[model samples]
Target: MKAEKKPIVSCKGITKVFGKDELAVHALRSIDLDIIEGDFATLAGPSGSGKTTLLNMIGALDHPTSGQVLIDGQPLSGMSKSQLSDLRLNKIGFIFQAYNLVPVLSARENVEFVLRLLKVEANERRTRADAALAEVGLRGLENRRPSALSGGQQQRVAIARALVARPRIVLADEPTANLDSTTTGELVDLMYRLNQESGTTFLIGTHDPRVMEHSKRHIEMTDGQIESDIRA
Candidate 1:
């Protein structure tokens, strides 16, 4: 039998509140979850349902008002800012709906930016960046700037950038929001393939049915709490 996978992410009694007193908004209410290694999961809910807020908490982009989170067995609440930054760089990758890329940088440079920040040597960075771009099907577009690429290509570049460092987990927030139906399908398919091949855990926040369909697990939230969790 295959060895049982471990939980790569865990949350307990997570509560996130913004503001205070009368103006307070509860973004997450006592959330409890675990994402096993290599799981392809989607957090789905309508607007104001706290999907993004929960994703932010999981990605260590925001702090919860109460409770704790653990990534790769390390407690997030105990980490300092620098430690958190290091954790993000080494263990986690983030992909956003906006496809944040430097306008002046070509696709290869964009993918190499993370490696540069990690102090990777130029030669290795270039090799890894090129390999990542090719993995995402952007082999010949390495010199193209973001403006020259279509939305899907740009998103693929973002994926390449995220995967270049070989992060254990990838967090994507509404990654398909800017793409058309066909592109969205392709993007999710690519992500699924990557998860299958690389065993990279994926936790995506999206209301898109296409994204949900491609994920192996579905977690639906409402009023800052998980309403359902179904595994395919």
Candidate 2:
């Protein structure tokens, strides 16, 4: 890392445990990680490892039992509930394996959901949603609903929704898990292009070798601990 580059996501001595003592499950150990601006990084591990836990911590969806998470160099530990919500709204984008689109909403509507949450004017919302869907190669399909689209298309809609607000960082979890190889390849290519061309920081969590190989930084985890962290 260059001295001038600032970390967008920083985890210092982070740990997460579920339950107490005998029934306890350690989801993460004292992990230290930093994702700088414009990084395309991945967390790779089997189901039981701490990859998802760490991602949740970074996303502010879950709090760590110990230590600190800083977004844009601001510590999350001291933020109030509303403050955290605002931070997530303005600074982060999230994509899930299930392509969590509302079944009844059209692609454009789904994409516009974020902007609407921000209370953007209707005209601008429509314009931005159209542009975002087009950027994901879904130009003419904006009116289609989730059930009418294929898995990849649905995922693309989800991506469009996530990116419509222009968040500085994107956090995707097992984004290719539900797609076929061809679809996965296509989606990966699209995300790679977005990460490169848009300069949005991407931190993905997956066990797929394909995802790991495409990432510029790969971190492997095992039993709630980081096994290896390497930059390509």
Candidate 3:
């Protein structure tokens, strides 16, 4: 097999502490991580093991108490909130356990939301939203509202929404939790194909065995520290 490419993201000696002094909680110990572009990697650990904390820091949703996070060689520490939001909007796609779609909006409209935020032309947004829905196998269902779609379909729409902006990184947090085994497999396969076709980097935080088995790289954490990093 070919060697992995240079890293698009690097985190060095990352540390996150909650509260302060005597009541402090060390959510994440010193951590060093490198994620290459197009890498489909999973962060696996039990609850409170710092997997989520690390992911949050990488996504710029939270800051570390010490150390630094770099995306495409740009340090995150000095970025303003607006700059961080701009980075997230342009470079990161997020998928959560909950299919957080608006009940009143159709799937197409939901996907169009991000493009709207970016001030994309209405016609172009419509075209891209439809294409994204079709990419996720939700073409005809694009007219349906979240309430009208099944759990799996709703998640697929959520995925379409995440990808509509064509962000560089996709951060998924327990995306399969609400899915059945079959649907879980389908979703994972879809994401894998997307990674191959679009070179979109995936950083998933999950405890599911299926996720661990399917990912190209697996990083295991324990007690707020990474125990192992392996590539298949």
Candidate 4:
């Protein structure tokens, strides 16, 4: 029998509460989940369902009020701020809905920014950035700035930026919110291909049916808790 694969990300009894006393708001409620490597999963729910909050917790951007998160089996609790920053830069990739690209930088430069932070050599950074852009079908647009690209193209640049580091996991929050139906389909297809070919895990927070349909696993959240988890 094949050995069981270890999860890339695991969350145990995660709960997040904002404010205190009467003003307290519960954002997550005793959530537990395991995201195995190469899995394409989507967190689907309406606004305020805590999908984005959960994503933030998993990405190490926010801490849970209770419980713990583990990335590649390393617990996040007790880590220093710099340590958490290192973990995010080295092990995780994030794609936001707004396509947070540097307006003045070219596509390649934006993709290379993380590499620079990691202190990779100039030549290697450029090579990896170029390769990532090409992989995302932005080969010739490498020199174009975000202002010069279309919405779909800008999002592709964001994907390349997120993937250029070759992280083990990618967290995307509403990645297709700004795109048209056709563009959304194409963007999700690109992400699906990346998951299949690179074995990188994806956990997306979205309400888009298009994204849910493309994902291999569907996790629905309601009232800050997981209502259903269905795997294909």
> How well is each residue in 1-232 modelled by candidate 2, as lDDT tens digits?
6578899999999999999999999999999999989899999989989888999999999999999999998999979999999989999999999999998899999999999989999999999999999999999999999999999999999888888899979999999999999888888888999989999889999977788778999999999999999999
For all candidates in order, the CA lDDT equals 0.93, 0.93, 0.91, 0.95
Per-candidate clashes, comma-separated = 0, 0, 0, 0
The C-alpha stretches of model 1 lying farther than 4 A from their native spots are none
What would the per-residue lDDT of candidate 3 be over residues 93-129, giving only the tens digit for each residue?
A: 8898998998889999999999998999999999999
Report the number of the highest-lDDT candidate: 4
List model 1 lDDT by residue over 1-232, tens digit each. Answer: 9999889899999999999999999989999999999899999988999988988888898898999999988889978989999999998999999999899999999999999989999999999999999999999999999999999999999999999898989999999999999999989999999999999899999989989988899999999999999999
lDDT tens string, model 4, 1-232? 9889899999999999999999999999999999998889999999999999999999999999999999999999999999999999999999999999999899999999999999999999999999999999998999999999999999999999999998989999999999999999999999999998888889999999999988899999999999999998
Cα lDDT for residue 108, model 4?
Answer: 95
**What TM-score fits each model?**
0.97, 0.97, 0.95, 0.98
Candidate 3 regions with alpha-carbon error over 4 angstroms: 1-4
Candidate 2 deviant stretches above 4 angstroms: 1-3
TM-score of 4: 0.98
- Error (Å) of candidate 2 at residue 182 is 0.6
Error of 3 at 197 (Å): 1.9
Q: Specify the poorest-scoring 10-residue window by lDDT in model 4.
A: 192-201
